[model samples]
Target: MTQTCLVTGGAGFIGCAISDALTAAFDTVVAVDNLHPQIHKTGARPAALNERVELIVADVTEPGTWDEVLAKHRPDTVIHLAAETGTGQSLTEATRHAQVNVVGTTRMLDALAARGIVPQRIVLSSSRAVYGEGEWLDAQGKGHYPGQRSAQMLEQGQWDFPGLRSQPFRCAHTKPAPTSVYGATKLAQEHILSAWCLAFGTGLNILRLQNVYGPGQSLTNPYTGIVSLFARMAKAGKSIPLYEDGHMLRDFVFIDDVAAAIVAAATSDKSGILADIGTGDSLSIAQLASVIGDIYQAPPPHVTGQFRNGDVRHAACDVSATRDTLGWTPQVDAATGARRLCEWIDQRPEQLERL
Candidate 1:
């Protein structure tokens, strides 16, 4: 018997890798992507996409987008990775985020139910933004999940928790508080899929990924990943701008590790499992800038004291449970991952031209 897997956003950075990984496990891999101009400058199939996979160019948010694909393919597994993913941009483009992330998910669910085509399992590429400020510890060592930072607080250049300290985020421990519009929409997708999957007895795996970066990431898309942005600036001999006094913490996971984790979740027998995919550690933004600067031999990064609205002060996940459940662990450290990313960017001069 032949099994097929359908991946939304399959031609993308993480998607392309997953599509390649799926070739060994599934008989057919079908990738549906809109090829948005921001991510795909040519608005065509990316060269990095695996040649063996079938590519379908379509927007997931559009009505009837999945009708023909669903009827024809009837995929056994579905990896939902299609969504708008700009945290800062989400503030100004709330409708676009909701339409694609929240409503777009519902559209897929509706189509599946209407057609009576229930995939055996569905995997969602969720974001850590749902943890909003994530887990914080007070003076007494108690955990607290704080709300979004106030405008006045940011203006005053206060970046940390008011009276508490941040702690490493554990997927099962951290509460979903979602500060950004993008985060809210992603949480909505998780909730929507959870209910639908439960009702239909479909397996579900929700992997809340940390800052995913590596080769094949969009160097042209300003909102894609901070690593790519910094690499571009450094390659251009420009000073990289460090925000919020450069103390903001993030867990930058390599793209290959993320793709492997997603593949494990899709292939594993586990159902109703929610886990965090990361390096299980974090680094300050300033440290990250220094690493990139050293790699490119560019000017030192300048700490701007600037803060973006909807940005979290600290975010790093405890991936212990993810390892136990998905049988996966991050293989690349931050420094090595950054170096690989810079090397890839260095080779692609055409991408830097659009910067």
Candidate 2:
């Protein structure tokens, strides 16, 4: 029996990496992607995509596209990674984010339902944005999920949530209170899939991923993934800009570890399970700039004091449950991952040409 796993958005950074991991487990792997021009500048198949994977160029938002694809290849597992990302971009392009992240997910579920196709499991690549300010700890060490920061507070250079000292934990226990449009749509994806899977008796696994960065990340996107952005600036002989006093915290998980987590979810027998995927640690944004500067031999990062609306103050997810359930652990640390990323970036100077 030939086992097949279909991955949406399977040609991009994380998708391509996930496709590579999936090929070793599933006999056949099919990738469905729109090949968005923002990521795939030529609107063609990415060279980084694994040669063994089959690529279907189509948007997930289109019902007909799903109908045809589902009828042809009923995969044993569906890993949904096709969605618009970025906190700053989502604020201005709310409809685009909602259409792709929320509507696209529902469209795929509707197609599966129409075809009476229930895959062995469906793995959703969710985001930590769903937790908003996430799980913060006050002076007394009491956990609290803060609301969206006001523009006045941001303009006053107030970065973190007042009286809070910590970030969110695992997704299974935290209640989602998304602050950005991107986060709202992601939470919507989880709800839609949960309802569908419940009615269909299909297994569902959701991984609320934190900041993921590595080799294939889009250096030109200009909207998300600050690691790639900072790397591009450093390559261009420019100083990295540190926003919000350079003290904002984030958990930068390596791409390989994230791919492994997704693969674990796809292969696991868990149903209605939610887990957070990250390094289980946190670092200040200024610290991230120092790492990039050291690797690129660029100028020191400057404290810009600029801030973006809809951006969370801190984001670090605990992966204890993920480790226990999926039997996965992060192998690469931030420093080592940055070194490896720079090596890969050096080989592709064309990516830095526009910088």
List the global CA lDDT of all models. Answer: 0.90, 0.87
Can you write out model 2's per-residue Cα lDDT over 140-249, one digit (the tens) per residue? 88887668889999999877766777655676677788889999999999999998888888899998998999988887787877887777788777899999899888
Candidate 2 lDDT score at position 246: 93
Task: Estimate candidate 2's alpha-carbon lDDT, on a 0 to 1 scale.
Answer: 0.87
- Which candidate achieves the best lDDT against the true structure? 1
TM-score of each: 0.98, 0.97
Residues 1-355, candidate 1, lDDT per residue (tens digit)? 9999999989999998777789889999999899999889888788888888999899898766888678678888999999999899999999999999988898888988988988999999999999899778888988887789999999999888778988877877788999999999999999999999999989999999999999988877888789888888887888889998998889999999999999999999888889999999899988998899988788999988888999999999889988888899999999999999999988988767766
**Candidate 1: lDDT of 159?**
82
Q: Give the TM-score comparing model 2 with the true structure, all chains together.
A: 0.97
User: Highest TM-score, which number?
Assistant: 1
